[model samples]
Structure formats: structure tokens, C-alpha cells
Target: RRLKKKHFVIECDPLVHEGFESTARHVEIPYLPMLVPPTKWKGYDKGGHLFLPSYVMRTHGVKDQKEAIKSVPRKQLRKVFEALDILGGTKWRVNRRVHDVVETIWSRGGGIAGLVDKGNIPLPEQPETEDPDEIQKWKWSVKKTKKANRELHAERCDTELKLSVARKMREEDGFYYPHNLDFRGRAYPMHPHLSHLGSDLCRGVLEYAEGRPLGKSGLRWLKIHLANKYGGGIEKLSHESKLTFVEDHLPDIFDSAANPVDGNCWWINAEDPFQCLAACMDLSNALESSSPHGAVSHLPIHQDGSCNGLQHYAALGRDYMGAAAVNLVPGEKPADIYSEIAARVLDVVREDSMKDPATDPSVPLAKVLVDEVSLLPAPLCLNQEIFFFMYLFFNKTVEDLDIGSLQVDRKLVKQTVMTSVYGVTFIGARQQIMKRLQEKGHITDDKLLYDVSCYATRVTLDALGQMFQSARAIMAWLGDCAKMIASKNQPVRWTSPVGLPVVQPYKKYKNYMIRTSLQCLALRREGDAIATQRQKAAFPPNFVHSLDSSHMMMTAITCKEAGLHFAGVHDSFWVHACDVDKMNQILREQFVELYSMPILENLLEEFQTLFPTVEFPPCPAQGNFDVREVLTSTYFFN
Candidate 1:
């Protein structure tokens, strides 16, 4: 009867039938979906072992019963696989107090409200008019409002899902999230709803099941971690300064932990509110203990990279200035790359504003010229009208310009600067800046907001080009190489430092209509022709990403070997407070080791070998800065 019911549902649901058909095409023999009857819930086995289902553990007709290790790529990949195994096996449990707050927020559909007040509800006033222009304007506003609401709804749903999973798993002794790598070899948790790889709320609700005693050093590091979560200038402080900042904020932190929703709600203002609250709670617990230094802690302390992609580029090119700007070399405090970029952009804008209209050829002038004798007393002449218009255009006074009104800060241009390495187009930068402006809710007029965003994007890109000259040249070289290879109708391919094979899968796809019982679905199938433009545009960033992943994997492997638990979110790495210093040393060593190899030269050689007839350009010239300097750089990863 159950089988009959399952079959009935499969037949009746067009989406399910389509999914089954798709699955069947990939496998040699398609089997019916597994059926689990409703029964008393039994979480995990008696010994606290949570085994992955047989279906999830199988690949290529081989079932992994013991370790659930899938097909290993190569020898180097084995180390990465081992690292992933170590990461996945790390146990975690819910912080019930934080979980309760998150659940409450989720129930209210206000998960995103903490990040952006009233962001979910965008209600534009409807115009009561029959005029076509007004109606069109109203329609556009409605469309934008709907888009905002949809995004909010999606976020709400995501919060609901995460909270539900956390609630169910809270009762267990602990649970583990399995890990997998993307095609670029970047590892991510396989569990969708709950893991360390989640937002601030998700992360806050979780704590390592295995606790370590917070010794003096560990306690100090934990204080530093708390300061880091508060962000702003606190994150740029030296270790001791950060600790001091945390100490200064002890009253606020304790209050936040004691009465999170009621008291001062100081944690709500933090960069990561929920996580900050969690850190506050941890700090409060440690301090309240009879032996503060001996208190057990399960919170993971993170040491994040500063503009990591640019850091890699700087290291690759040996650009000392770029390296220093990104905190690659030793420094008292962590570098603020975003603020530096913002300052550069402001300088450019100010310089542009101060340009002489009469001498500068770029400045627009009034086309009409009027004699002083022809000045009319009753009304202005055509020349006067033109001159008046050009006066506003060419000569914007400091007060009229209101450069400060734009509030060109680190936050405004951070996203643009970050993605500039990945070949963000001018239009893309404008959109990114526009989104930031919209979120800030400063410029109410859409037209003026868009103009400001466009202006900001130009200056941001200009600043980046000036600041990271070597990175720009390298990006150009990579793009050129990709174009040369892709013009011959072949996808660009490369090997990462960790020997993970990477192939740019960008290609033209042919769309075909598949008629189903309920609807006609348009499906895309890979075509023989290569997508040359996409291949060229994506290669530089993709190649950089592969290298980034390589560095991460190397660090992960060494951390495991050194008996340290590790969790990585791309450039951001996390470990136990006691093990942070060890993990940092390991990461720095791995980064230096990874870059020490002739990476670009090897890539050129590989390209030559793969396409013998095609002549690739020489690798970008390197600077004089030593890669070993990273070893001594304290803020290289912090």
C-alpha cells in the first residue's frame, strides 16, 4: 500500500517525475526512492555515532561503510580528503540560549531585520493618476518593492529552515556536518541548513562539543576574538589593544549576555550581532567562574585574511606596497584596505571637482557666446541661458557638490573593491554601489542615487587600479592567456598548487524543449562550441580561486597533522582559542610554501603542452619582495 501511494505521488507530480528522469539519465540503473515508515524517533546509535545513509556513502558502485570516503582524486588530493575528513568529524552542538533567541526572531520573520531595519517590507506609495508617465513610474516602483519583498521572504524561509534543524539537533550529544569540495576544490559543508558555514545567527547557535580549558593565553585570545566581532576600528587594533577594548566593554558585554533582549541590547549594534552575543556569553561565563583561566570554552576563534584575493595577487607579484597594504608584512596593527581604498577614491573625487573649467579640455563649455552690449534687461538671451546651464555643469561648488553627502566610506566601496579582482565590469560596479546606497537609505531620488553610484564606481575602480598596479597587470596577463586559449574553441585548464585538476567548464549550451505531462520544460545541454568571452572573463578569478583553495587545503592538512581542529570559510580560518597561534603559524607557512613554487611559469608550460601550436605570452614579471616575509607577518591572516 505504501509502495502504491509512493508511485501514485511520483506519477501525479510533474516536478518529481522530471527530477527522477534527470537522475535516471546520470545513472546506469535507476532505483526507486527509499521509503522510511513513520515510527518513534531514534536520533543516533547508542555510542553517539551518526552514520551517513548507504546511498549518501556510495559512488561508482562502491559503498564506503567505515569512513565514507569517496573516490580520491590523487595523492595530493588524499591529504585534502584527509583534511576534509578531520573537519567533518569535528563535533558541534547548539548553544540553547542563543538558539532560543534565534528561534524567536525566526518566528517573527525578523531574522533579516537585525541586519537591515524594515528591509523586508518595502511599500512604495501608489500614484492615483491616469497619466501614462506617472503610471509607468508607479509600475517601476511596484516592481522594485516586489523584488525587495521577495528577497526578504526568501531570507525568512532560510532562517525558518535553519532554526528548525537546530531545534531538532539540539537534544543530541553532538552532531557533525559532512564536507565536500566544489569543482574549484573549495571545501564546504554538505549539510545545507546548519553548519559553521552559516550566517552570524547560525554560527552563534553552534559551539564545539569538545571543550578545551581556556588557559591564560586562551583567555586573552578569546577577548581578542570578542573585539574582532565588534568590528570597526576594534578589529584593526593590535592583540593587546583588542584585549584592552574587550576589557573596556566588559560592562556592556556582560549586560548583553545577561539580558540580551531586554537590557541595553549592546550586542545588536555589533558587526555580527548574534555571534557577538555568543562571544559575550562566553566571556561572561569565563569571568564569573571561580577560576577564570581554567574555564572550559568551545567557541571557535577566527583569524581572517585581509582582502585575501588581493593578498594572493600581491604575494604572487611580490608587490611590497600592495603586500603591506593588505597586512602581508609585519605590522603593529592590521591594515585597513577598505579605508585606504575609500580615501583614495575621495582624493580622486576632490581632484576631479577642483579641475579648472577654463583650462581643462575635458570640461564642458557653453556653445553660445554673447557680447556685453547685447545684454537684455527684460529677459535673458539664448547665450545667457546656455551659459547659466553650463555654469552648473562645469562649476559645481564644494557646497553644491556635497561630496560628504555621498558618505564615501569603506562600506560603500568594499564590495566593488573586493570584486574588482574578479573582473567586475563598470555596470556591475555601479549596480553593487547602487545596492549599497539603497541599503543606506540616504539618497531617496532613484535618478540621483544611480548617478552617485555611477560616480562612486568609477572612482573606486580608478583607486584600485592605482593602488594595485601589479595585480592589474597580472589580471590582464591572465585574461590575455585565457583569450588566446579560448579563441581556439578550447576551455582553459590549469592545476592548482595542491595538484587539484581544474578545468574551466564554460561552454555554449543548446536549449531544447522537453514536453512533460503538465508542462514543456526548456532544458539546456552542453554544446561543442566553447563560450570564448565567458572563458576569458572567468579564467583569472577562477584561477585565483583555485590557488586560494589550494592554500586553504594546505593549511587544513597541516592543522590536522599538528593535532588542531580546523574550520575554514574560504579566506577566514577558525580554530580553538588555545590552538589559534599554532593554526596561524601553519597557515602562514603553507601560504609561503604554496607561493614559493614557480606557479605562473608552470601554468605557462602546461598551456604550451596542452596546446602545442598556440603560443602563450611570457609570465608576468615578479617584484623584488621576498615571499618568506609572510612568515614574520603577524597580521598576514588576522
Candidate 2:
């Protein structure tokens, strides 16, 4: 009955049997055992049962799934392989595929219901002495939340669109087929994700951008410029030219013979014993010596569609790019860092646009957007940051990360800085029909003024008759996100862009509920606490991730082209202090290019095709969101 050897952590729940207590020990099971315990297995202390370590594949020298499984959990290995065969082929990494298999199994009655039905666990009895009215209210909330989740899932998924893209990508590149677990068109981080593979305009424009950094230009200017460049930048390029310019161009750039090498590559190669000793040794070597750039072997810049809360906008541009990484050389600022980083970012974007990943961009894009945005808690943003602080705390450095002349606030490092975009939160709340925004998030110290640019911005309950304006812009934004999450949870099922199906097993919203009495007493519990929180926080975080990914990607490429050392932690881009100025300049220009295109309109167009039957609202006018307004401060990158 155990379909997977590596089943859910049953010991975590107290609902199981507590008889036959025994001393902690490790034993070899006979049956060509389905699950393999990790290398330093600590036997779980349950009456007499053993809870093996959580599944993990060794990071070193794992060339294939077979090699990977030798170290990772063996239970369900066959199931994972079967699923992968159906999904595609060995185009995915072992770790990621393992994760997918576990999730797939869990999603398909492998968790809550499986435990109760197969494990013979008894559900907690309903409280007999509780007040009836409170129970009914809890029941109603749970019902509504379940409904919302299902609807949101449907809005996010579009399997047909995804499967088509995957097929095409496989035909184009055998080794890499973009697949986000949920099948959103956004390419899995492991591969490239361009616009629809068949569209020349989309691919052509993308190539031009990737190959070079051109300042902001209208479509007309772009066409003319590309035309002047021997028509290589457009769909009209000779088949040979397409091969030479885009596909071949990027690989050439990453090679040592073609491009300059700057600082050493600095990456965490060791585990933190406090940090891993082995990784530290490798990082030490890279920091002291030079490494490759511009290719898959180095800091390969890439671009794809994004879901920066403004999916409508990322769709407009249709690509997110990250450049190469360089190590920080003490006081060694490479000259022209700005131009270098810009050139690298542009090249990567253009190249990736021509590459194309999954056909569907919804889920991959949403995942990227949703994953990062979920990292930000309004409380942390309005106060100080947590992630970057943890970094600084670990490194013991007090100097703020600087880009050219701008210094990033440590608090904003992990969380994207919310500038004028705070206004967007209110606009969204209104659109979603959020009625009492003022009553939502709390104000810090009862003062309605928020800190901004060495001055206080006078935020009120309702600015210009807006319902979502408040003391802290982050808090206001989160209030709306919470509403949106609740709304998304109200459905039974939804599909992702890549054809991954997500069906809710619960009949009510108990899984979406927090650590409240109802959840503690229910037959089911929200397995993924973080995902539940993201549903509550909503779009702002998604937007933040897209924006951050794009920004970092651009910086990575810029540094690669300029031949400067480039590495970063989330929002903080790291390079030799000397290259900071050029980093700023190149990023500014790239920012313009990123926004210059008609993104909002394009997103609407994408939506039209992705969800052909649904009618969407008119695209927001260009004036509605001015990049000039967003780029006014470097805080977003900080």
C-alpha cells in the first residue's frame, strides 16, 4: 500500500500510535528497500518507529538521476521516473525532478487522506462543548477560502498552451526543455524562456536586445535600427544569420578567447558548518583566480517573461535577464562598470528571447513572481529587513552595499523597495473591490507619515479618495494581497502553464487557515505554511520577485560584458567598488529598455491567447505606470 517509500513525515503528527517504545537506532531493511536513509541518519525517537531523514540528493558529481538516486530517497524513484517520462524526458535535474515527484505524490492524496486512510490514524473529535455560532462562522470562512483557491488555480493554469510549448522546445533543444512544476510559460530557472517559439517579431526583437544594449526606443526606431543592422535584428533575417547572430553569438561571448575576464567568480561552494568548509575552499579559489563568463559554464545571462505583480507589464517586455557573477576585489573598481553590465544584460536578454523555453508563460512566470514576493512581510519592510541582515550578520560587515553613488538600505535588500508603485496597491484593491482598506493593516506609532528620501510622505486613510492609502505603503499593499489570496482559494482546482494540474482535495478552507483552533481541530492541516501565507499576501510579492529577477539578471550580464567581477545577494549587486559607477549607468539605461516597450498592452495580448475564451479588461494606458516614476530611486534594486 506504500506507493512511495519516502512518504510524508508521519512522526511530525501526534495522531499516530505511541506503543512499543525503543532506543534510537539504524538498521538495514531487506526488500531492496524503497527509501534510503541519508548519510548521518539520526533515528527518530517514537515508541519504536524510525523516522528517516528528509530526502536530499548529494550536490557533487551527480551526472544523472541514477547517480542522484544513489544518495537520495529511493522510495517513489520509479514513480518519479514514470512521471518525468510522461512530462517529457531526462531534461530536468535529479533534485528538481525528485521534488516534483514528491509534490505530485503528495498532491494526489498522498498526504492527509492517505495518512488517515492507510496509516490508520484517527481524526481529532469535534469539540462538543464549543459554541455553535463560532463553529458555523469558522465553517463558512473555510468554505469560502476553499472556493477561492480553486478559482485562482484555474486562472493560473493552462495545460494545453504549456504542452505545445514544451513539445516545440524539445524539438529545438533536446537537452533543455523548460518545465516549471506548475507549467506556467515562464521557463524553469534551469532553462531559457523566450516568447512563443514560433513568433518572429517576438524572437527577432528579443535577439537584438540580447546582443546589445540600446537606449529606450519606440517600435519604429527599433525596426529601423534593426533594419540598418543588415536586417539581422528582425524576423526577416536569413536563416543562416539567425543561427550566426543569436544561437552562436551567446556561446561565443562566454568563451575566454572572445571576451575579457574580470574578477574571480565567487559562489558558495561549501556548506555552512557555520558555512561549509569544502564550499569555502572552492569559493576562496574562485575569489583569488579567474573563471569563465558569458556561457552556461559561467554566469550565463538569460531573459524570460515575468510576473512582477504586474504580469500585465512583464508580459509586455516578455523576458527577464540575469548577468554573470564577479567577485569583489578590495578597492579594485573596474572602469566603465555601467556600460559593461548593461551590455551583458542586453546580450543575454536578446539571446534568450531567441532561444524560447516553455510555450506557456503563466505558471513559470507566476511562480517566479509569487515565490519572491512572498518573501517580503510588510512588517519587515516597514521596519528593517531580515534576510540581508542575516547575511551581514553572518559576514559581520556593516558597510551598506553601494551601486555607483547609491547605497542600498539593508532593510530593503531582500524586499524590493516600494516607491511610487505603492499607489498601484490601492488601484488593485479598488479593482478587486476591497472595501475597507483603511481598516486593514496597522500604522507604525500611530503616525500617518512614512519615511522616504530623508523626508516623510504624508500618507492618510484615503489619499485622493483612494481606499488603500495608508501610513506604510507595504502594509497597504499587503492588505489587498490578503484579500486576493482569500479570493484565489475559493475554487476546487486550477492548471499551471506547463500542463501541471493542481486539484484541491479538501472540501473546505481548513488547509488555508492559519494556526487557529479550527485548523488544529480539523481532519486536515495546511501542509505548506509558506504557500498558505503567500495566498494571503497576494500580488505585490510576485511583482517584487519578477522585478528583482530582471534587475539582478541585468546586472549579471552588464558585469560580464564590462569584464568586471559581478555577484549579488538578492537585491544587492556585488562587484569591485571601482565598477560601481558604470554598474549604475548601465542599469539605468537597461531599465529604460526594459520598460520602453508597450508591456501592459502586450501582457493583455498574451492573456488573450493563453485564455482564449476569457475577455480581459483593456490594457492600462502607458501613462498609468511611468518607468520614470519607478526609476526615480534605486531602492527597488536595493
Report residue 258 deviation for candidate 1 (angstroms). Answer: 1.1
Per-candidate clashes, comma-separated: 0, 68
Q: Name the regions of candidate 1 deviating beyond 4 angstroms.
A: 1-73, 108-136, 357-406, 514-521
lDDT agreement with native, every candidate: 0.71, 0.28
Per lDDT, the best of the predicted structures is 1
Candidate 1 structure, TM-score to reference: 0.80
Per-residue alpha-carbon lDDT of candidate 1 for residues 555-601, written as tens digits (9 for 90 to 100): 88889888887888889998888888898889999999998898899
lDDT of 2 by residue, 1-638 (tens): 66763423334232221121110011122211111111221111111112432222222221322232343333423322222222222121112221232233333533221111112223234456589987776676667665664443332222222222333333222232212221111212112232322222112211111112222222122222222222111222222332333222232222311111221211111111101111122122232344311111111111211112322222232212111101111112211222223223222323333443586322232222122222334234221123234333443211122121111121211112122233334333332212221222222222221211111111111221231122134334333433433344431122222222222222222333245643332354433222444443433344444444454445555556776544333344433323444555565555655566553454446545545555545532222334443233322221
Name the runs in model 2 displaced over 4 angstroms: 1-537, 624-638
Native-to-model Cα distance after best TM-score fit, residue 282 in candidate 1, in Å: 0.5
TM-score of each: 0.80, 0.27
